[model samples]
Target: MPHRSISAPRHRAPALPSTDYDVIIIGAGSAGLSAALSLGRCLRRVLVCDGGPPRNAPSPGVQSFFTRDGIKPAELLRVGLDQLKPYDTVEVRAAQVQRVTPGFQVFEVEAEGESGRTFTVTARKLLLATGVEDELPPVPGMRDLWGRGVLHCPYCHGWEVRGQALAVYGQGKIVTGMALLVSRWAPDLVVCTDGAGHLSPNARRRLRQQKIQLNEEPISHLEGTANGQLRHIVFKNGDKLARHALFVHPHQHQRSTLAEQLGCRLTSKGAIWINKHSQTSISGLYAAGDITPGPQKALLAAAEGTEAAIAIHETLTREECPK
Candidate 1:
Protein backbone atom coordinates (compact mmCIF):
# COMPACT_ATOMS: atom_id res chain seq x y z
CA MET A 1 0.00 0.00 0.00
CA PRO A 2 1.16 3.53 -0.71
CA HIS A 3 1.69 5.93 2.17
CA ARG A 4 -0.30 9.18 2.24
CA SER A 5 0.42 12.25 4.33
CA ILE A 6 -2.41 14.06 6.08
CA SER A 7 -2.28 17.79 6.59
CA ALA A 8 -4.12 19.75 9.24
CA PRO A 9 -7.25 21.63 8.16
CA ARG A 10 -7.05 25.32 7.49
CA HIS A 11 -9.10 28.03 9.21
CA ARG A 12 -11.22 30.26 6.99
CA ALA A 13 -11.38 34.01 7.52
CA PRO A 14 -14.69 35.72 8.13
CA ALA A 15 -16.09 38.24 5.69
CA LEU A 16 -14.95 41.83 6.17
CA PRO A 17 -17.72 44.30 5.37
CA SER A 18 -16.23 47.76 5.00
CA THR A 19 -13.01 49.51 4.13
CA ASP A 20 -13.10 52.29 6.74
CA TYR A 21 -12.85 52.29 10.51
CA ASP A 22 -11.93 54.51 13.43
CA VAL A 23 -9.06 52.22 14.34
CA ILE A 24 -7.52 49.22 12.57
CA ILE A 25 -5.64 46.79 14.72
CA ILE A 26 -3.14 44.23 13.38
CA GLY A 27 -2.70 40.92 15.20
CA ALA A 28 -5.71 39.73 17.23
CA GLY A 29 -3.91 38.26 20.17
CA SER A 30 -4.47 39.34 23.76
CA ALA A 31 -3.12 42.80 23.06
CA GLY A 32 -5.26 43.38 19.99
CA LEU A 33 -8.43 42.10 21.65
CA SER A 34 -7.84 44.30 24.68
CA ALA A 35 -7.45 47.36 22.47
CA ALA A 36 -10.54 46.44 20.50
CA LEU A 37 -12.58 45.97 23.69
CA SER A 38 -11.60 49.40 24.94
CA LEU A 39 -12.33 51.05 21.62
CA GLY A 40 -15.64 49.22 21.22
CA ARG A 41 -16.72 50.33 24.66
CA CYS A 42 -16.05 53.87 23.58
CA LEU A 43 -18.34 53.34 20.55
CA ARG A 44 -15.43 53.48 18.11
CA ARG A 45 -15.52 51.45 14.92
CA VAL A 46 -12.64 49.01 15.43
CA LEU A 47 -11.39 46.30 13.09
CA VAL A 48 -9.00 43.60 14.21
CA CYS A 49 -7.04 41.70 11.53
CA ASP A 50 -6.13 38.41 13.13
CA GLY A 51 -3.52 36.37 11.36
CA GLY A 52 -3.84 32.88 12.80
CA PRO A 53 -1.12 30.99 14.69
CA PRO A 54 -0.44 33.27 17.65
CA ARG A 55 2.89 33.16 19.45
CA ASN A 56 1.36 31.01 22.19
CA ALA A 57 -0.44 28.69 19.78
CA PRO A 58 1.96 25.86 20.50
CA SER A 59 1.46 26.12 24.27
CA PRO A 60 -1.12 23.99 26.01
CA GLY A 61 -2.25 26.68 28.39
CA VAL A 62 -1.54 30.23 29.45
CA GLN A 63 -0.03 30.99 32.85
CA SER A 64 -0.05 34.03 35.15
CA PHE A 65 -3.04 35.59 33.38
CA PHE A 66 -5.05 36.13 36.59
CA THR A 67 -8.55 34.55 36.39
CA ARG A 68 -7.74 32.89 33.10
CA ASP A 69 -4.64 31.20 34.43
CA GLY A 70 -3.91 27.71 33.03
CA ILE A 71 -6.54 28.18 30.32
CA LYS A 72 -5.74 27.12 26.78
CA PRO A 73 -4.41 30.01 24.72
CA ALA A 74 -7.04 29.47 22.04
CA GLU A 75 -9.87 29.30 24.56
CA LEU A 76 -8.69 32.46 26.21
CA LEU A 77 -8.78 34.23 22.86
CA ARG A 78 -12.25 32.82 22.17
CA VAL A 79 -13.53 34.17 25.48
CA GLY A 80 -12.05 37.54 24.69
CA LEU A 81 -13.75 37.58 21.32
CA ASP A 82 -17.05 36.55 22.93
CA GLN A 83 -16.85 39.43 25.35
CA LEU A 84 -16.83 41.82 22.41
CA LYS A 85 -20.11 40.43 21.09
CA PRO A 86 -22.25 43.21 22.57
CA TYR A 87 -20.22 45.75 20.64
CA ASP A 88 -21.36 45.71 17.05
CA THR A 89 -18.73 48.28 16.26
CA VAL A 90 -15.89 45.77 16.65
CA GLU A 91 -15.09 43.27 13.90
CA VAL A 92 -12.44 40.59 13.63
CA ARG A 93 -11.16 38.84 10.49
CA ALA A 94 -8.58 36.14 10.08
CA ALA A 95 -6.37 37.86 7.54
CA GLN A 96 -2.68 38.51 7.14
CA VAL A 97 -1.83 42.16 6.60
CA GLN A 98 0.41 42.61 3.55
CA ARG A 99 1.40 46.28 3.77
CA VAL A 100 0.47 49.53 5.44
CA THR A 101 0.53 52.80 3.52
CA PRO A 102 0.10 56.30 4.95
CA GLY A 103 -2.55 58.66 3.70
CA PHE A 104 -3.53 62.27 4.22
CA GLN A 105 -5.63 61.68 7.34
CA VAL A 106 -5.84 57.89 7.50
CA PHE A 107 -3.67 54.84 6.99
CA GLU A 108 -4.32 52.25 4.26
CA VAL A 109 -3.97 48.61 5.26
CA GLU A 110 -3.86 45.77 2.74
CA ALA A 111 -4.59 42.24 3.95
CA GLU A 112 -5.13 38.85 2.31
CA GLY A 113 -7.40 36.19 3.69
CA GLU A 114 -6.85 32.46 3.68
CA SER A 115 -8.97 32.14 0.57
CA GLY A 116 -6.64 34.50 -1.25
CA ARG A 117 -9.22 37.28 -1.14
CA THR A 118 -7.57 40.66 -0.80
CA PHE A 119 -9.07 43.55 1.10
CA THR A 120 -8.13 47.10 2.00
CA VAL A 121 -9.12 49.21 4.97
CA THR A 122 -8.45 52.80 6.00
CA ALA A 123 -8.29 53.91 9.60
CA ARG A 124 -7.68 57.09 11.56
CA LYS A 125 -5.26 55.20 13.81
CA LEU A 126 -3.34 51.93 13.56
CA LEU A 127 -2.29 49.64 16.39
CA LEU A 128 0.27 46.86 16.08
CA ALA A 129 -0.10 43.92 18.47
CA THR A 130 1.83 41.65 16.15
CA GLY A 131 4.02 39.81 18.65
CA VAL A 132 7.49 38.41 18.05
CA GLU A 133 8.44 35.01 16.59
CA ASP A 134 10.61 32.60 18.54
CA GLU A 135 13.52 31.35 16.46
CA LEU A 136 14.39 27.98 18.01
CA PRO A 137 17.74 26.26 17.72
CA PRO A 138 18.13 23.66 14.96
CA VAL A 139 18.56 20.70 17.31
CA PRO A 140 16.45 17.72 16.25
CA GLY A 141 13.12 17.27 18.10
CA MET A 142 13.49 20.68 19.78
CA ARG A 143 10.66 22.12 17.71
CA ASP A 144 8.35 19.32 18.77
CA LEU A 145 8.90 20.10 22.45
CA TRP A 146 8.59 23.84 22.14
CA GLY A 147 6.10 25.42 24.59
CA ARG A 148 5.85 22.08 26.35
CA GLY A 149 8.98 20.72 28.04
CA VAL A 150 11.16 23.01 25.94
CA LEU A 151 10.06 26.49 27.05
CA HIS A 152 11.08 30.09 27.62
CA CYS A 153 10.08 32.88 30.01
CA PRO A 154 10.76 31.74 33.55
CA TYR A 155 8.00 33.92 34.93
CA CYS A 156 5.44 32.42 32.54
CA HIS A 157 6.23 28.71 32.90
CA GLY A 158 8.58 28.56 35.89
CA TRP A 159 5.93 28.02 38.54
CA GLU A 160 4.37 25.14 36.63
CA VAL A 161 7.66 23.26 36.40
CA ARG A 162 9.04 24.29 39.76
CA GLY A 163 11.67 22.08 41.34
CA GLN A 164 11.79 19.84 38.26
CA ALA A 165 15.06 18.63 36.74
CA LEU A 166 15.49 21.59 34.44
CA ALA A 167 18.14 22.52 31.87
CA VAL A 168 18.90 25.87 30.29
CA TYR A 169 19.75 25.50 26.59
CA GLY A 170 21.79 28.19 24.87
CA GLN A 171 25.08 30.15 25.05
CA GLY A 172 26.25 33.75 25.62
CA LYS A 173 25.63 36.32 28.35
CA ILE A 174 21.88 36.32 27.82
CA VAL A 175 21.67 32.57 28.24
CA THR A 176 23.72 32.81 31.44
CA GLY A 177 21.35 35.48 32.71
CA MET A 178 18.38 33.28 31.84
CA ALA A 179 20.01 30.38 33.64
CA LEU A 180 20.32 32.55 36.72
CA LEU A 181 16.66 33.52 36.44
CA VAL A 182 15.59 29.91 36.01
CA SER A 183 17.59 29.05 39.14
CA ARG A 184 14.96 30.84 41.19
CA TRP A 185 12.45 28.04 40.49
CA ALA A 186 14.81 25.21 39.64
CA PRO A 187 17.51 24.57 42.24
CA ASP A 188 18.84 21.57 40.28
CA LEU A 189 19.70 23.32 37.02
CA VAL A 190 22.13 22.46 34.23
CA VAL A 191 23.37 24.83 31.54
CA CYS A 192 23.71 23.23 28.10
CA THR A 193 25.97 25.24 25.82
CA ASP A 194 24.78 23.29 22.73
CA GLY A 195 28.39 23.37 21.50
CA ALA A 196 28.48 27.17 21.25
CA GLY A 197 30.97 27.58 24.18
CA HIS A 198 30.55 31.34 24.31
CA LEU A 199 30.21 31.68 28.06
CA SER A 200 32.55 34.30 29.54
CA PRO A 201 35.04 33.55 32.31
CA ASN A 202 32.96 35.53 34.78
CA ALA A 203 29.85 33.59 33.80
CA ARG A 204 31.64 30.26 34.20
CA ARG A 205 32.98 31.31 37.57
CA ARG A 206 29.54 32.36 38.69
CA LEU A 207 28.04 29.09 37.51
CA ARG A 208 30.74 27.14 39.34
CA GLN A 209 30.17 29.15 42.49
CA GLN A 210 26.47 28.52 42.16
CA LYS A 211 27.09 24.76 41.70
CA ILE A 212 25.43 24.76 38.28
CA GLN A 213 26.71 22.11 35.88
CA LEU A 214 27.79 23.35 32.44
CA ASN A 215 27.66 20.95 29.48
CA GLU A 216 29.54 22.02 26.33
CA GLU A 217 28.71 18.93 24.27
CA PRO A 218 26.90 19.31 20.97
CA ILE A 219 23.25 18.35 21.28
CA SER A 220 22.15 15.57 18.95
CA HIS A 221 18.45 15.77 19.72
CA LEU A 222 15.75 15.92 22.38
CA GLU A 223 13.86 12.79 23.44
CA GLY A 224 10.30 13.50 24.43
CA THR A 225 6.93 11.80 24.77
CA ALA A 226 4.38 11.68 21.97
CA ASN A 227 2.64 14.64 23.56
CA GLY A 228 5.86 16.71 23.55
CA GLN A 229 6.86 16.23 27.20
CA LEU A 230 10.64 16.25 27.19
CA ARG A 231 12.38 13.28 28.79
CA HIS A 232 16.06 13.51 27.92
CA ILE A 233 18.66 15.63 26.16
CA VAL A 234 20.72 13.35 23.92
CA PHE A 235 24.25 14.55 23.14
CA LYS A 236 26.23 13.81 19.98
CA ASN A 237 28.72 11.71 21.99
CA GLY A 238 25.90 9.30 22.99
CA ASP A 239 25.57 10.67 26.54
CA LYS A 240 22.11 11.73 27.70
CA LEU A 241 20.91 14.20 30.31
CA ALA A 242 17.58 13.54 32.01
CA ARG A 243 15.61 16.75 32.07
CA HIS A 244 11.93 17.23 32.83
CA ALA A 245 11.98 20.79 31.54
CA LEU A 246 14.28 22.94 29.43
CA PHE A 247 14.50 26.70 29.51
CA VAL A 248 15.73 28.36 26.35
CA HIS A 249 16.61 31.88 25.22
CA PRO A 250 15.78 31.57 21.55
CA HIS A 251 16.32 34.45 19.11
CA GLN A 252 13.16 36.45 18.38
CA HIS A 253 12.01 38.67 15.52
CA GLN A 254 8.95 40.77 14.83
CA ARG A 255 6.08 38.69 13.46
CA SER A 256 5.09 41.35 10.98
CA THR A 257 7.02 43.89 8.88
CA LEU A 258 4.25 46.49 8.90
CA ALA A 259 5.84 48.33 11.80
CA GLU A 260 9.18 48.74 10.06
CA GLN A 261 7.43 49.54 6.76
CA LEU A 262 5.60 52.36 8.55
CA GLY A 263 8.97 53.71 9.75
CA CYS A 264 8.36 53.01 13.44
CA ARG A 265 11.61 53.19 15.34
CA LEU A 266 12.76 49.96 16.98
CA THR A 267 14.55 49.50 20.28
CA SER A 268 17.99 48.00 20.77
CA LYS A 269 16.27 44.68 21.47
CA GLY A 270 14.41 44.92 18.13
CA ALA A 271 10.99 45.71 19.61
CA ILE A 272 8.88 48.67 18.60
CA TRP A 273 9.82 51.86 20.45
CA ILE A 274 6.75 53.41 22.06
CA ASN A 275 6.18 56.21 24.54
CA LYS A 276 4.01 56.14 27.66
CA HIS A 277 0.96 56.65 25.46
CA SER A 278 1.86 53.58 23.45
CA GLN A 279 2.34 55.79 20.41
CA THR A 280 5.22 54.87 18.11
CA SER A 281 7.47 57.16 16.06
CA ILE A 282 4.67 57.67 13.55
CA SER A 283 1.99 60.11 14.72
CA GLY A 284 -1.07 57.88 14.17
CA LEU A 285 0.73 54.61 14.79
CA TYR A 286 0.64 52.85 18.18
CA ALA A 287 1.96 49.54 19.47
CA ALA A 288 1.50 47.22 22.42
CA GLY A 289 2.36 43.72 23.67
CA ASP A 290 5.49 41.67 22.98
CA ILE A 291 6.13 43.71 19.83
CA THR A 292 7.01 46.65 22.06
CA PRO A 293 10.05 46.82 24.31
CA GLY A 294 9.39 45.39 27.75
CA PRO A 295 8.69 42.21 29.68
CA GLN A 296 6.60 39.85 27.51
CA LYS A 297 3.46 38.81 29.35
CA ALA A 298 -0.19 38.39 28.36
CA LEU A 299 -1.52 40.58 31.16
CA LEU A 300 1.06 43.29 30.55
CA ALA A 301 0.26 43.30 26.85
CA ALA A 302 -3.48 43.62 27.51
CA ALA A 303 -2.88 46.55 29.87
CA GLU A 304 -0.75 48.30 27.30
CA GLY A 305 -3.41 47.71 24.67
CA THR A 306 -6.05 49.29 26.86
CA GLU A 307 -3.74 52.26 27.44
CA ALA A 308 -3.11 52.60 23.72
CA ALA A 309 -6.83 52.56 23.01
CA ILE A 310 -7.41 55.33 25.53
CA ALA A 311 -4.57 57.36 24.06
CA ILE A 312 -5.98 56.90 20.58
CA HIS A 313 -9.43 58.00 21.70
CA GLU A 314 -8.04 61.09 23.37
CA THR A 315 -5.96 62.01 20.35
CA LEU A 316 -8.87 61.57 17.98
CA THR A 317 -11.16 63.60 20.22
CA ARG A 318 -8.65 66.41 20.43
CA GLU A 319 -8.41 66.67 16.68
CA GLU A 320 -11.98 65.95 15.58
CA CYS A 321 -14.02 67.56 18.37
CA PRO A 322 -15.03 71.19 17.85
CA LYS A 323 -13.63 73.59 20.41
Candidate 2:
Protein backbone atom coordinates (compact mmCIF):
# COMPACT_ATOMS: atom_id res chain seq x y z
CA MET A 1 0.00 0.00 0.00
CA PRO A 2 1.35 3.47 -0.91
CA HIS A 3 1.79 5.85 2.02
CA ARG A 4 0.08 9.21 1.81
CA SER A 5 2.35 12.15 2.57
CA ILE A 6 1.19 14.58 5.24
CA SER A 7 1.03 18.02 3.70
CA ALA A 8 -1.31 20.24 5.73
CA PRO A 9 -4.02 19.88 8.31
CA ARG A 10 -7.43 19.21 6.83
CA HIS A 11 -9.10 21.72 9.11
CA ARG A 12 -6.14 23.83 10.24
CA ALA A 13 -5.85 23.15 13.96
CA PRO A 14 -2.77 23.68 16.08
CA ALA A 15 -0.94 20.59 17.21
CA LEU A 16 -2.22 19.02 20.41
CA PRO A 17 0.02 18.71 23.45
CA SER A 18 2.23 15.65 23.46
CA THR A 19 0.43 14.44 26.58
CA ASP A 20 -2.80 13.77 24.69
CA TYR A 21 -3.50 11.89 21.46
CA ASP A 22 -6.40 12.47 19.12
CA VAL A 23 -7.33 8.84 18.68
CA ILE A 24 -6.37 5.57 20.33
CA ILE A 25 -6.74 2.68 17.92
CA ILE A 26 -6.69 -0.83 19.35
CA GLY A 27 -5.36 -3.66 17.18
CA ALA A 28 -2.45 -3.19 14.75
CA GLY A 29 -3.89 -5.37 12.02
CA SER A 30 -4.80 -4.04 8.59
CA ALA A 31 -7.66 -1.95 9.97
CA GLY A 32 -5.80 -0.14 12.74
CA LEU A 33 -2.65 0.48 10.70
CA SER A 34 -4.61 1.78 7.74
CA ALA A 35 -6.48 4.13 10.03
CA ALA A 36 -3.26 5.43 11.47
CA LEU A 37 -1.95 6.13 7.99
CA SER A 38 -5.03 8.09 7.03
CA LEU A 39 -5.32 9.96 10.32
CA GLY A 40 -1.61 10.76 10.25
CA ARG A 41 -2.01 12.32 6.83
CA CYS A 42 -4.86 14.41 8.26
CA LEU A 43 -2.45 15.61 10.97
CA ARG A 44 -4.11 13.55 13.72
CA ARG A 45 -2.13 12.10 16.54
CA VAL A 46 -2.73 8.34 16.62
CA LEU A 47 -1.65 5.76 19.15
CA VAL A 48 -2.13 2.16 18.03
CA CYS A 49 -1.93 -0.63 20.61
CA ASP A 50 -1.68 -4.19 19.42
CA GLY A 51 -3.28 -6.48 21.98
CA GLY A 52 -1.61 -9.61 20.65
CA PRO A 53 -1.18 -11.64 17.51
CA PRO A 54 -3.66 -10.84 14.78
CA ARG A 55 -6.70 -13.08 14.27
CA ASN A 56 -5.25 -14.24 10.96
CA ALA A 57 -1.99 -15.40 12.57
CA PRO A 58 -2.51 -18.99 11.52
CA SER A 59 -3.14 -18.23 7.86
CA PRO A 60 -0.05 -18.84 5.73
CA GLY A 61 -0.81 -16.25 3.08
CA VAL A 62 -3.35 -13.52 2.44
CA GLN A 63 -5.36 -14.06 -0.71
CA SER A 64 -7.99 -11.87 -2.42
CA PHE A 65 -6.27 -8.66 -1.39
CA PHE A 66 -5.32 -6.34 -4.20
CA THR A 67 -1.61 -6.04 -5.08
CA ARG A 68 -0.48 -7.72 -1.86
CA ASP A 69 -2.00 -11.10 -2.61
CA GLY A 70 -0.31 -14.19 -1.13
CA ILE A 71 1.73 -12.07 1.32
CA LYS A 72 2.34 -13.66 4.69
CA PRO A 73 0.15 -12.16 7.40
CA ALA A 74 3.10 -11.21 9.59
CA GLU A 75 5.08 -9.82 6.66
CA LEU A 76 2.14 -7.74 5.52
CA LEU A 77 1.87 -6.23 8.99
CA ARG A 78 5.64 -5.68 9.05
CA VAL A 79 5.48 -3.79 5.78
CA GLY A 80 2.54 -1.77 7.05
CA LEU A 81 4.39 -0.79 10.21
CA ASP A 82 7.51 0.05 8.25
CA GLN A 83 5.58 2.31 5.91
CA LEU A 84 4.22 4.28 8.89
CA LYS A 85 7.75 5.31 9.93
CA PRO A 86 7.51 8.62 8.08
CA TYR A 87 4.35 9.57 10.02
CA ASP A 88 5.85 10.91 13.23
CA THR A 89 2.47 11.62 14.77
CA VAL A 90 1.42 7.99 14.56
CA GLU A 91 2.82 5.74 17.31
CA VAL A 92 2.49 1.96 17.38
CA ARG A 93 3.00 -0.05 20.54
CA ALA A 94 2.71 -3.64 21.74
CA ALA A 95 0.72 -2.74 24.82
CA GLN A 96 -2.42 -4.69 25.67
CA VAL A 97 -5.26 -2.43 26.72
CA GLN A 98 -6.44 -3.60 30.10
CA ARG A 99 -9.44 -1.34 30.60
CA VAL A 100 -11.08 1.76 29.27
CA THR A 101 -12.86 4.43 31.39
CA PRO A 102 -15.27 6.80 29.75
CA GLY A 103 -14.97 10.46 30.68
CA PHE A 104 -16.55 13.73 29.59
CA GLN A 105 -14.74 14.29 26.30
CA VAL A 106 -11.77 11.99 26.82
CA PHE A 107 -11.25 8.34 27.61
CA GLU A 108 -8.73 6.92 30.05
CA VAL A 109 -7.10 3.73 28.87
CA GLU A 110 -4.97 1.41 30.98
CA ALA A 111 -2.53 -0.88 29.27
CA GLU A 112 0.36 -3.17 30.14
CA GLY A 113 3.62 -3.30 28.23
CA GLU A 114 5.82 -6.26 27.39
CA SER A 115 7.73 -5.81 30.67
CA GLY A 116 4.46 -6.09 32.64
CA ARG A 117 4.65 -2.39 33.37
CA THR A 118 1.31 -0.64 33.26
CA PHE A 119 0.53 2.93 32.19
CA THR A 120 -2.48 5.11 31.61
CA VAL A 121 -3.16 7.25 28.59
CA THR A 122 -5.95 9.44 27.37
CA ALA A 123 -7.37 10.04 23.90
CA ARG A 124 -10.24 12.17 22.68
CA LYS A 125 -11.56 9.53 20.30
CA LEU A 126 -11.32 5.75 20.58
CA LEU A 127 -11.37 3.35 17.67
CA LEU A 128 -11.70 -0.35 18.31
CA ALA A 129 -10.22 -2.05 15.29
CA THR A 130 -9.85 -5.16 17.38
CA GLY A 131 -11.00 -8.12 15.31
CA VAL A 132 -12.88 -11.29 16.17
CA GLU A 133 -11.71 -14.73 17.31
CA ASP A 134 -12.62 -17.93 15.51
CA GLU A 135 -14.08 -20.62 17.76
CA LEU A 136 -13.42 -23.88 15.95
CA PRO A 137 -15.11 -27.13 16.81
CA PRO A 138 -13.68 -29.53 19.43
CA VAL A 139 -12.80 -32.15 16.85
CA PRO A 140 -9.22 -33.37 17.25
CA GLY A 141 -6.58 -32.01 14.87
CA MET A 142 -8.90 -29.24 13.77
CA ARG A 143 -6.80 -26.53 15.36
CA ASP A 144 -3.61 -27.95 13.91
CA LEU A 145 -4.94 -27.83 10.38
CA TRP A 146 -6.43 -24.38 10.77
CA GLY A 147 -5.27 -21.94 8.07
CA ARG A 148 -3.83 -24.88 6.18
CA GLY A 149 -6.13 -27.83 5.51
CA VAL A 150 -8.91 -26.43 7.76
CA LEU A 151 -9.95 -23.09 6.32
CA HIS A 152 -12.58 -20.38 6.35
CA CYS A 153 -13.66 -17.78 3.80
CA PRO A 154 -13.60 -19.39 0.40
CA TYR A 155 -12.61 -16.10 -1.16
CA CYS A 156 -9.48 -16.10 0.95
CA HIS A 157 -8.33 -19.69 0.49
CA GLY A 158 -10.67 -21.38 -1.96
CA TRP A 159 -8.46 -20.96 -4.99
CA GLU A 160 -5.56 -22.69 -3.23
CA VAL A 161 -7.71 -25.73 -2.45
CA ARG A 162 -9.65 -25.63 -5.66
CA GLY A 163 -9.89 -28.99 -7.46
CA GLN A 164 -8.54 -30.67 -4.32
CA ALA A 165 -10.66 -33.32 -2.63
CA LEU A 166 -12.41 -30.95 -0.25
CA ALA A 167 -15.16 -31.26 2.38
CA VAL A 168 -17.29 -28.72 4.22
CA TYR A 169 -17.70 -29.21 7.99
CA GLY A 170 -20.63 -28.01 10.05
CA GLN A 171 -24.28 -28.86 10.67
CA GLY A 172 -27.83 -27.68 10.01
CA LYS A 173 -28.72 -24.93 7.56
CA ILE A 174 -25.36 -23.21 7.94
CA VAL A 175 -23.48 -26.23 6.65
CA THR A 176 -25.90 -26.68 3.80
CA GLY A 177 -25.35 -23.06 2.78
CA MET A 178 -21.60 -23.44 3.18
CA ALA A 179 -21.56 -26.57 1.02
CA LEU A 180 -23.40 -24.76 -1.73
CA LEU A 181 -21.00 -21.83 -1.53
CA VAL A 182 -17.93 -24.05 -1.49
CA SER A 183 -19.25 -25.91 -4.54
CA ARG A 184 -18.39 -22.88 -6.70
CA TRP A 185 -14.79 -23.60 -5.74
CA ALA A 186 -14.94 -27.37 -5.33
CA PRO A 187 -16.79 -28.95 -8.23
CA ASP A 188 -17.32 -32.16 -6.30
CA LEU A 189 -17.74 -31.45 -2.59
CA VAL A 190 -18.60 -33.42 0.53
CA VAL A 191 -20.74 -32.03 3.32
CA CYS A 192 -19.69 -33.51 6.67
CA THR A 193 -22.31 -32.66 9.26
CA ASP A 194 -20.43 -34.69 11.92
CA GLY A 195 -23.75 -36.37 12.90
CA ALA A 196 -27.50 -36.10 12.24
CA GLY A 197 -27.22 -33.38 9.60
CA HIS A 198 -30.62 -31.82 10.51
CA LEU A 199 -30.98 -30.79 6.89
CA SER A 200 -34.39 -30.10 5.40
CA PRO A 201 -35.80 -32.13 2.50
CA ASN A 202 -35.22 -29.20 0.16
CA ALA A 203 -31.66 -28.85 1.36
CA ARG A 204 -31.07 -32.53 0.70
CA ARG A 205 -32.57 -32.19 -2.76
CA ARG A 206 -30.35 -29.22 -3.53
CA LEU A 207 -27.27 -31.13 -2.38
CA ARG A 208 -28.22 -34.08 -4.55
CA GLN A 209 -28.65 -31.74 -7.51
CA GLN A 210 -25.22 -30.33 -6.87
CA LYS A 211 -23.85 -33.85 -6.31
CA ILE A 212 -22.57 -32.90 -2.81
CA GLN A 213 -22.20 -35.98 -0.63
CA LEU A 214 -23.49 -35.53 2.92
CA ASN A 215 -21.74 -37.47 5.65
CA GLU A 216 -23.65 -37.42 8.93
CA GLU A 217 -21.27 -39.85 10.60
CA PRO A 218 -19.52 -38.38 13.61
CA ILE A 219 -15.87 -37.57 12.94
CA SER A 220 -13.46 -39.21 15.36
CA HIS A 221 -10.48 -37.11 14.32
CA LEU A 222 -8.58 -35.79 11.36
CA GLU A 223 -5.33 -37.11 9.92
CA GLY A 224 -3.08 -34.86 7.97
CA THR A 225 0.25 -34.77 6.14
CA ALA A 226 3.55 -34.24 7.91
CA ASN A 227 3.25 -30.54 7.15
CA GLY A 228 -0.16 -30.44 8.91
CA GLN A 229 -2.31 -30.22 5.80
CA LEU A 230 -5.39 -32.32 6.46
CA ARG A 231 -5.51 -35.59 4.49
CA HIS A 232 -8.26 -37.74 5.95
CA ILE A 233 -11.37 -37.69 8.09
CA VAL A 234 -11.31 -40.59 10.51
CA PHE A 235 -14.71 -41.73 11.75
CA LYS A 236 -15.71 -43.34 15.03
CA ASN A 237 -16.70 -46.55 13.23
CA GLY A 238 -13.15 -47.03 11.88
CA ASP A 239 -14.13 -45.68 8.50
CA LYS A 240 -11.91 -43.07 6.89
CA LEU A 241 -12.49 -40.67 4.00
CA ALA A 242 -9.75 -39.02 2.01
CA ARG A 243 -9.92 -35.26 1.93
CA HIS A 244 -7.29 -32.69 1.05
CA ALA A 245 -8.93 -29.75 2.84
CA LEU A 246 -11.86 -29.03 5.17
CA PHE A 247 -13.70 -25.75 4.94
CA VAL A 248 -15.48 -24.61 8.08
CA HIS A 249 -17.35 -21.47 9.06
CA PRO A 250 -16.63 -21.70 12.72
CA HIS A 251 -18.25 -19.52 15.37
CA GLN A 252 -16.55 -16.21 16.21
CA HIS A 253 -16.57 -13.56 18.92
CA GLN A 254 -14.92 -10.23 19.46
CA ARG A 255 -11.27 -10.51 20.43
CA SER A 256 -11.55 -7.46 22.64
CA THR A 257 -14.30 -6.44 25.12
CA LEU A 258 -13.61 -2.72 24.88
CA ALA A 259 -16.63 -2.16 22.67
CA GLU A 260 -18.90 -4.14 24.96
CA GLN A 261 -17.44 -2.53 28.08
CA LEU A 262 -18.11 0.90 26.63
CA GLY A 263 -21.75 -0.10 25.98
CA CYS A 264 -21.52 0.19 22.20
CA ARG A 265 -24.44 -1.33 20.35
CA LEU A 266 -23.76 -4.69 18.78
CA THR A 267 -25.40 -6.42 15.88
CA SER A 268 -27.40 -9.62 16.35
CA LYS A 269 -24.30 -11.55 15.34
CA GLY A 270 -22.23 -9.76 18.06
CA ALA A 271 -20.41 -7.31 15.81
CA ILE A 272 -20.21 -3.65 16.68
CA TRP A 273 -22.92 -1.59 15.04
CA ILE A 274 -21.62 1.45 13.22
CA ASN A 275 -23.21 4.10 11.08
CA LYS A 276 -22.17 5.20 7.61
CA HIS A 277 -19.21 7.02 9.18
CA SER A 278 -18.10 3.96 11.18
CA GLN A 279 -19.04 5.68 14.44
CA THR A 280 -20.53 3.24 16.89
CA SER A 281 -23.59 3.77 19.05
CA ILE A 282 -21.43 5.56 21.58
CA SER A 283 -20.30 9.03 20.56
CA GLY A 284 -16.59 9.26 19.81
CA LEU A 285 -16.37 5.49 19.83
CA TYR A 286 -15.83 3.84 16.44
CA ALA A 287 -15.07 0.41 15.10
CA ALA A 288 -13.72 -1.19 11.93
CA GLY A 289 -12.42 -4.52 10.69
CA ASP A 290 -14.05 -7.81 11.68
CA ILE A 291 -15.19 -6.32 14.96
CA THR A 292 -17.95 -4.63 13.02
CA PRO A 293 -20.60 -6.40 10.95
CA GLY A 294 -19.33 -7.28 7.47
CA PRO A 295 -17.27 -9.78 5.57
CA GLN A 296 -14.01 -10.38 7.39
CA LYS A 297 -11.20 -9.72 4.97
CA ALA A 298 -7.96 -7.77 5.22
CA LEU A 299 -8.77 -5.53 2.25
CA LEU A 300 -12.28 -4.72 3.54
CA ALA A 301 -10.93 -3.96 6.98
CA ALA A 302 -8.34 -1.56 5.54
CA ALA A 303 -11.00 0.17 3.46
CA GLU A 304 -13.24 0.56 6.49
CA GLY A 305 -10.29 1.89 8.47
CA THR A 306 -9.62 4.55 5.83
CA GLU A 307 -13.28 5.51 5.87
CA ALA A 308 -13.32 5.70 9.68
CA ALA A 309 -10.22 7.89 9.67
CA ILE A 310 -11.81 10.37 7.29
CA ALA A 311 -15.01 10.45 9.39
CA ILE A 312 -13.07 10.83 12.62
CA HIS A 313 -11.14 13.77 11.24
CA GLU A 314 -14.37 15.36 10.12
CA THR A 315 -15.93 14.80 13.52
CA LEU A 316 -12.96 16.42 15.18
CA THR A 317 -13.13 19.34 12.79
CA ARG A 318 -16.80 19.89 13.52
CA GLU A 319 -16.16 19.82 17.26
CA GLU A 320 -13.43 22.45 16.91
CA CYS A 321 -15.44 24.79 14.68
CA PRO A 322 -19.09 24.17 15.42
CA LYS A 323 -21.14 26.79 13.57
Cα TM-score per model: 0.92, 0.94
Encode model 1's per-residue lDDT on 18-83: one tens digit a residue. 448989999899999999999999999999999987899889889999999999999999999999
Residue 14 error, candidate 1, Å: 36
Against the true structure, candidate 2 reaches a TM-score of 0.94
Q: Model 2, 164-211: lDDT tens per residue? A: 889999988899888998998887689998889899999999999999
For model 2 the local lDDT of residue 304 reads: 95
Off by over 4 Å in 1: 1-19
Q: Rate the local accuracy (lDDT) of all candidates.
A: 0.90, 0.90
Error of 2 at 64 (Å): 1.1
